[model samples]
Target: MSVVRAGGDGRTEADGTGRAGLRTLLRAADGVRIDVAYRPGPGGREGRGGPDVIVVAHGFTGDLDRPHIRRIAAGFARRAAVVTFTFRGHGRSGGRSTVGDREVLDLAAAVAWARSLGHRRVATVGFSMGGSVVLRHAALHGGGDPDTDAGRTARTRTDAVVSVSGPARWFYRGTAPMRRVHWLVTRPAGRVVGRYGLRTRIHDKDWDPVPLSPVQAVPLIAPTPLLIVHGDRDPYFPLDHPRMLATAGAGAADLWLEQGMGHAEHATTDALVARIGEWLEKRG
Candidate 1:
């Protein structure tokens, strides 16, 4: 069953926009309890919605309540209602982090929850690891999002999708940061650090029969308004990643290689965030 709470602290709290926030513990198709947060925009109704709603997916090791994630949500709230959530195995969510594998189910639960809240023009924006999730989710459920709840279909489709600093292919260890990330998700000792130091519980199993890569999923996102944004100075997956994605998109997606930008949410600037909001607004 889905559990809905008005605020993070049990009492509804304003999102600094004079609008109260809604928190929820949603059940994924796999029965994972995913923690989600939503902040309505100006003139936006609590359960109903404004002109648009953007689902912001945080990167690995990040959660809905992080300061950076909050900042992005606040920026997006300027143009549309914003929804953010913690993937399984992160923050207050249940289950182990499959990194990017089964995390698609986590995102599906969040999108379904947002629709249940009454939003119609819903979009998805992801950072780094989240970037991958949005792409795959849109490809899999863009038409009529397949609700993974065993037997329920929640109409969790996305109107637009944005992937910021996402990797094109899997198992890429070209950069030092990526190498460290590989260790964090691969090694048992690293999993210990991920659990204790990063507060991220990663699954011990590997991707049995590897899932679809970001580039492979890009083509399927056609007609869904795909936007791929990456930093020129990203320390993680480099420029080649986005380039590969753009190639895979084959003119179906928009590519933005921001100058001097780095990887994911930490490197995203307020100006860029505003620009992203503008992009979403334009679509609506």
Candidate 2:
């Protein structure tokens, strides 16, 4: 049974039966509505003490409804409560995609909501562009840093962060796939394709001051555990991306360079997702 209830702070709640989980609409700090879903851990329930929660952020053009996203959430639900959301411009969410920028607010709200549901520990697991957002979100809101804008409203710290197939820097066109992505993000014809073919609404402008890059942000996430996972054959970014992130993280991050992996959700196997869940459980 799915029922929607709108909250004052731009949150809309819903209750679904069994393992299907609860669904909601949360407002980003910037006013965009983010569509979210929450699945309880094994034997877990809301308003009761339960397993730690994992906020799963999807990649570019992917949403909560995507099969891989659902599969990943299901895998995590075995060990932890799972919260999955559609970033702005994707799926049922409102507003345009800023790619990785401004999506931090969406994540912050989701994290906040997860904590509000009475989960004591909240970890983040992000894929691709979402991976970069997880890194920056941890830096801005998880490390107890006072300088970041996200810190003002974030009531709970992100206990752990896992970045899968994320880029270390922004504006990268080093690879053919990346070059094509840049074209899709910048050109009018490409925007049309993104709108119809990909179902992603691309933002028109370029970065101004430029948001903090993943490598740059990873340093500030120290004291908070972090895991950086990348595929050896990732078409969007090479091994250098994870290496740069691991280097910036110094001793605080764990790097996993999968030998046979290719990229993002499509390439991630069920066994790999279960392993990631176990990793979160050990740290939780």
Candidate 3:
């Protein structure tokens, strides 16, 4: 792993290589850091413009080196600058996971890194928890109502967003199994683990999924296109989540329910690759 000091003086590490001229860059912020593996197009020169830049964010407990992440990044590398990174407290990155709260900052840092590398257009493709991070970042940074607490200055402007098997609600009200899982994992275990200063396990912390819900952030995305992909067989968020997001976003969003697919499993399918490529082609 390669370590470096982020703009905020935090320690961070990188653990992957780029295709062709592309490279991996690491950044740290206030003791929290993230790893961004950037893959430039084959014929593209460093610091030169390319087709588009796509930031691939992994799910909770995931990292830049995950097989699914690498696959998605490889798929996009042919047409755009693809970047995959580890959220804080995961893999070579530092600090604890604040659910999707602080991870937004990490995403912002990744976006800045991509911009610095000469990417003109940017898009964020996230899976599960990572999907929430991208949505929340887009909502906070996108031009929205300035009066709301969720509203903040736009840090990174994205041309589009793609979410795979992401939840629209943190509490999982309608899904009994998911709610049980949340209560079982986050409530007691999260508190216990957090007390020891260890990373927050899946069910340890009381993370308000509402704040990260794309249903709430849809309006904020406004004209920015959104592509919501989920497995019909997903036991986590269920199909209603994406359906609601699509309905809420009106025509600004499109929902793709992969029949027989499960959470994170769709990442490996050719359909996903085609869908993502089509979306980028239309929006890039």
Tell me the whole-model lDDT of each prediction, alpha carbons only.
0.85, 0.85, 0.69
Stretches > 4 Å off in candidate 1: 1-11, 44-51, 145-154
**Please, what are the lDDT tens digits per residue for candidate 1 over residues 1-284?**
13345554443556444567777688888998888888887663445422367899999999987999998888888777888999998989999999898899888888777777777678899999999999998888867543344333336668899999999999999999989999999999999999999889999999988999899999998888888999999999889899999999899888999999988999999999988877776665
Instruction: Please give each candidate's TM-score.
Output: 0.91, 0.89, 0.78
The positional error of residue 91 in candidate 3, measured at the CA in angstroms, is: 1.2
TM-score of 2: 0.89
lDDT of 3 by residue, 108-224 (tens): 788767766776678888889888888887887764332333522433556678888888866565777566545545676545554344343333455654455667877788677
Top TM-score: which candidate number? 1
State residue 197's C-alpha deviation in candidate 2, in Å.
1.1
Local error of candidate 3 at residue 209 (angstroms): 11
When summed lDDT is taken over every stretch of 10 residues in candidate 1, the lowest stretch is 145-154
Better of 1 and 3 by TM-score: 1
- Return whichever of 2 and 3 wins on TM-score: 2
